[model samples]
Target: MTKRFLHITTLFVLMISVVLTGCGTEPAANDSGKLQVTATTGMIADLAQRVGGEHVEVSALMGPGIDPHLYKASQGDIQKLQQADIVLYNGLHLEGKMQEVFEQIGKQKPVVAVTDQFAESSLIASGVGGGTHDPHVWFDVKLWSGALDRIEAELIKNDAAHQADFEKNADAYREELAELDQYAREQLAQIPREGRVLVTAHDAFGYFGKAYDLEVVGLQGLSTDSEYGLKDVQNLVNLLVERKIKAVFVESSVPKKAIESVVKGAKAKGHDVKIGGELFSDAMGSAGTPEGTYPGMVRHNVDTIVKALK
Candidate 1:
């Protein structure tokens, strides 16, 4: 989990050069007649593939365990966006560095924010200035299902001939989401109310907490771009000791050092706080792995939390 930042001037120059030069292979409309789709995250790519089925070729800009908060667009990503027939991303400023790039690309093709269908009132404000909403809304299966509507609509609009296939796929996927939500509720309910506290490296589980009745705490802020000072560590340590919370978690995309420090602090205060397990926050698990997909990630989180807290 390296926190790397790219210079804005460098990125701007690279993007402009690419846009002006028109380098790289221009995406042909017919690669077996598949609609060229590019998504910013794996979750969005998975949705596009599921809905578009054989009719679309989807590419994800960010892969497993890559923190989007610190992710910057590369020359290759810019080329992919230019070649794509449609682009989809999670908009709450989640892709912190790529916002300007997405805006610039929107002028050329259909650039869609999958979560834009959500009303402002439904979003949780990122208390850190600049008016950002928590981007990890997929943790709540119900809210995530809403994304299917956007994906389906975009696919149909772009390729009207595949409207029937897109609708059929979306309906099946929604049913799977409903089952996943039920599975989450049933599994999470087993943990005692007091043991439902979830402490992690960053504040990425607000939606999960609201949907599953857990209390979440993070050493850092909504975006992993923020730092956790000694004061932040001390406060969390104090809370863990006072509440006798059994476990805290590490995120797959964020560094585990903050979580480990909190555990050490609690031990000094005569409390034993164990590192529960790694949770998928900003990114999903590896491709072909169980946790690589959305449902698998959520189920793994629920099982891990239940075992550690209960």
Candidate 2:
């Protein structure tokens, strides 16, 4: 079916389901009495769980190694969104295909773009133009902390009875994030100035480089859907050779072959760049692992980059 037709069908089904089931005006908590939060990505889900602690049960539509840029909502995902008390997502076209779904759901319930509160000046332009901004704001710990505030506000708006709980949780979580930001700074500083280059499979690390003061080069554009020709690979290879860069990292959400190609090309030119490590870009690591949570993922990326480049 056509993409537009599928979206329409999904919306129709969702509305019918909501009407038949009779969505109540009360907070949509589950039997356990926790606010049912549905987030578009794992990172946002982590934020919701952290800030909504003991009062919210969170689910992420896109999980580990899943790319939100090309993700289309499945019928199951629509059901999750329909059942959620509040929906959270990264804005700026991060969930490109699901924008219409979020819009439709917003008519019935609270749908929040966590990045909506950010100032225009704080965002990085995609440079591919058409006035697009990079959606990977979570790479910068301080910026991602802003999302906690937004999420907390929305939660309180939806469930005011627990405003105090949300506030306390948010404050504690913000403190953890503050420590993480400092840790990232001190660790990344170990890499000498000449070696502070981060070459990755895609341009997902622009915010990371900007936050951490590393020069980042990506083999592909912001979205994984963006195509990369031999010219792109060759250009990156040229940068690696010219700078004598020793490592290039792959992304968990993107194919490894892209960085592998860059490495092969660099090798062909005698630079000997190795695959530094896999960085969690659009996705986190598997569940129950250190690399799975946002702080852990950021720590993992920082440590990996420093180890390879320092």
Candidate 3:
């Protein structure tokens, strides 16, 4: 009787273990034919979705207003990366700490750096040495439009079956981006020559300013993750005094203290200064907001710059 009871308990345990094992072995819940697309930031996700359309299940690793320059991944993120059919990142050292990880993963997966398509001359100096790459290539709609061509090319390479669909969606989005670019030029007409200056939390908008013909001054350098030195603050004070620029801007991702200091400095010098508006520097706004999408983000930026400068 004791032997029979022990045998019954062992069989019950085995059955429970098998049941648990089957539960664990259950396949991924999502049963869609959609591509498991992952992008480093919301901007890239939006672009990839526009190009990939309904065939892809697009997701952003970094949500709106999240800083890519210092973004780090979690265990869940690793699983997502591994599962992704295509892992798209801005890839101008934008992910900063995670750049090395993505570099390694690129060996196994299709990890395409969209920003690599930009010309070196178009990049800003790192200030670390003779050359540094600027990761904020999306600020300029023209530059972003150029990146889309590369994006389309790569998408076509990955999923050739949906080549026509991808091309169709990409072409339409590209046209919209072109139209947004034209709108930027038109809206920026609101600001006067001298008033076309943009003072911001960081130097992310160099491309945008250069393309739009504005004097772009950043309280900090290209990367927000970069520390500010005394010389940096002093230099900005001198420039602000000289330029007599009034509206200093703060970025949504960066701390406001630095720009606030500039505002205080300008005021101490008897110059009227104010926080222009928070700009979407590192990330986009919430999905439904004006800054949610790339074109809307650029449009918001143009409107803000013109409003502040004019």
Candidate 4:
């Protein structure tokens, strides 16, 4: 009787252990048998979806017009990250507030940065010691293409079964990016060198300026976390007047008031500077629109800048 009781207890314990282990295990692919991917921003989501193709399901935590600088992870975002088979984000502190959440999620699964391929020498320096990097590497078409390769490798790492599909999709997208780069050069070349000054709400255009040979001025620093004072506005106004800049741009993600203030300040100094157009910075345009796609966004910006400054 004693031996039989011991055997029953051992069986019960083994069953409980199995249940707990199953609960902790990662989930399999979804009903569609696609690798589930969650990206922190729409740009990353679009890239992942395009690269992953039919073998992956991708979604964005922050959607159109959302500013990643100030965005924080919500409960829904947390839940999505927890359930995702893989997570991709734009690193270099672009998602400033969500770092801790991302780190926590990384413990469970792969949390990859699309921009991690950029070498330190390739990054734009920011801040006191230049210890930090500007996270807006997407503005440079050539630089962003590198991310395609990285994303492909990651997808393959997670779902080796779909390696062929990911590679094919990435190759096709790379060709499209090359064409977009050429288009931007042609459009921007139309603007006179003297008129190639790009003034925007913040310092999100360093990569764009470097790649296209434009001088970029932002009202605020690289990260929008810093405050902008009247002195800063006055300084930019003086620059616009001195340089005879015709147009300044407002960003879709940043508040327009800062750019508007600069315009007002310039006008007060007897220089009429017009608001060129709203540019997609930090965030892409609404989905289903031409501006919503990466290629479309770059073309729209180039056209807007050329038409305004030419």
Candidate 5:
């Protein structure tokens, strides 16, 4: 572990000690009688909101454009988790740095991973060793529907009185996801097979490529914490030139420099590859916007990819 992570862990332990001493019991529902749910990512937060409906007041720790892999919880974030009736995270090491914090808070209340319901066959291996699976399951619309079931189950378990309401909301939301899944399939099908390659700054879209039948290449590995060298850039440039690929996309959460370097390298190699558009990979767009919601984010990505590659 790096010095920063070690420092954060130390601070987290201290904070948790104080929180545990101050509160000996589970947090009660807010004045609105809604469960105070803390989710680690915007996608998971959206899931909690849709499934819990009026019974939940959801807060996302990692906001739009914030990369979860490198996110370290702050003392305030720890306080949020401590005060929450339940905590929800993407798990699968997506919030890698915050795992210890979650473990500590989990002892105090329900801490659930949205991807817990996924079978071994449903996950894609990161190939980074140690049997790690890719944590970006939300990219697959149908696969992400599993998260709805998990979240609804948790909400009902915590607030059993609202079981019927939660079930109703989940059914409605599932229909919307079914529609979004079909939209993604139809839209992404427009790209010709040869032009269906999606090159981005990182490997967060492996599930997306598998779901939509596109080939994905990333300059960086699964985590932005992973590094890339000059040779990696040259290799990607060569692939783009060889495949006659016209576009490369940058991610909102990751810096644009890496993809920019690839674009520069491609130009030098006589391949006119352009930065297709900014894609929401690890993060979503601003709150209150269409892209801020899960379905909107998926639609935006599908439209952007189709328009660029078609």
Candidate 6:
């Protein structure tokens, strides 16, 4: 063959070899050069993973059932945050103890505070146990859809190549979350109006109750760290006695003792209040478990509440 022809033929073969060899199949766990992502909780981590797709390696500071409100970031956690390309956290003081650390990271990394992006008017006050916003947004799937969009925007900003993929996943996940909301409403519909009262260890489910037309009576405030005054516990127990409520729930993230106290007090007042199955309040189930996903977490809570109250 002529030299010119040979050179062109070689180049064409090389290009074809690269394509045929599946050179692009290893779809980049490091899409913008090994993006390290850290999320505050499992729910946020799951969203980050969906939005990041194969472009990012995501880690959550708070694992399933680990309360973000009281999470103390260890030395290793700091390193994760320091090295991460993007940091995702639910704002509104959901990570109460770790708030300052996350705030510090925001100055350096492409930190996206998901909850703060929502309207303040949408947040309900913690009522007597005063925190400005209720941060258990994942329980209310509609609210979480807004948060998911913010996460997608951040992922796109950090890794432009995955923008379309990120958007596609976001749209799909948003639809799923929307469906969860509808299902939640339907599941909750089974409960009678007076039986719709959800008394739990903390006020995390305020948004859930508001979204699903349930009455949420929380023993404590927004944070599990928020101490329940004697009067508050007494009032809850008294109410349970008077209302003839059968069950109260303890949170997986919060100590079970508190809810047990409520149960005991209710019994003393001539009422039978069982300690219902543990609910996911500030966090979710273990990483590999069904409740690790947003839909499963909310579904579990809805089913638990329905079984207890209905």
Task: Give one digit per residue, the lDDT tens place, for model 1 in 229-283.
Answer: 9999999999999999999999999988889999999999999999989989888
Sliding window of 10 residues with minimal summed lDDT for model 4 = 11-20
Comparison by TM-score, 1 against 3, better one:
1
lDDT of each: 0.87, 0.87, 0.78, 0.84, 0.90, 0.78
Off by over 4 Å in 1: 1-6, 13-17, 20-29
Backbone clash count, each prediction separately: 0, 0, 1, 0, 0, 0
Candidate 5 at residue 247, lDDT?
A: 96
TM-score of 3: 0.87
Error of 6 at 225 (Å): 1.8
**Tens digit per residue, CA lDDT, model 2, 1-310:** 3577577657655664564357554444468877899999999999999989989889998999898877766767767887888889999989865666677677778899999989989999999878889999999999899899999999999889999999999999999999999999999999999999998888988888898899988888898878999999999999999999999898898889888988899899988988888899999999999998999999999999888999
Q: TM-score of every model?
A: 0.94, 0.92, 0.87, 0.90, 0.97, 0.86
Q: For residues 1-310, could you state the per-residue lDDT of candidate 5 as single tens digits?
A: 7898788777877788778778776674468878999999999999999999888899999999899888877777877887799899998999866777777777788999999889989999989789889999999999999998999999999999999999999999999999999999999999998999999999999999999899999999999988999999999999999999999999999999999999999899888998889899988899999999999999999999998999
TM-score attained by model 4: 0.90
Worst 10 residues of 2 by lDDT: 20-29
lDDT of 3: 0.78
Show the colliding residue pairs in model 3.
126-132
Give the Å error, residue 59, model 1.
Answer: 1.3
Ordered from best to worst TM-score, the candidate numbers read 5, 1, 2, 4, 3, 6
lDDT of 5: 0.90
Could you tell me how far off, in angstroms, the CA of residue 253 lies in candidate 1 after the best superposition?
0.4
Residue pairs that clash (backbone atoms under 3 angstroms), model 4: none
**Best prediction by TM-score:** 5
lDDT of 5 at 267: 94
Give the C-alpha miss distance for residue 192 in model 4, angstroms: 0.5
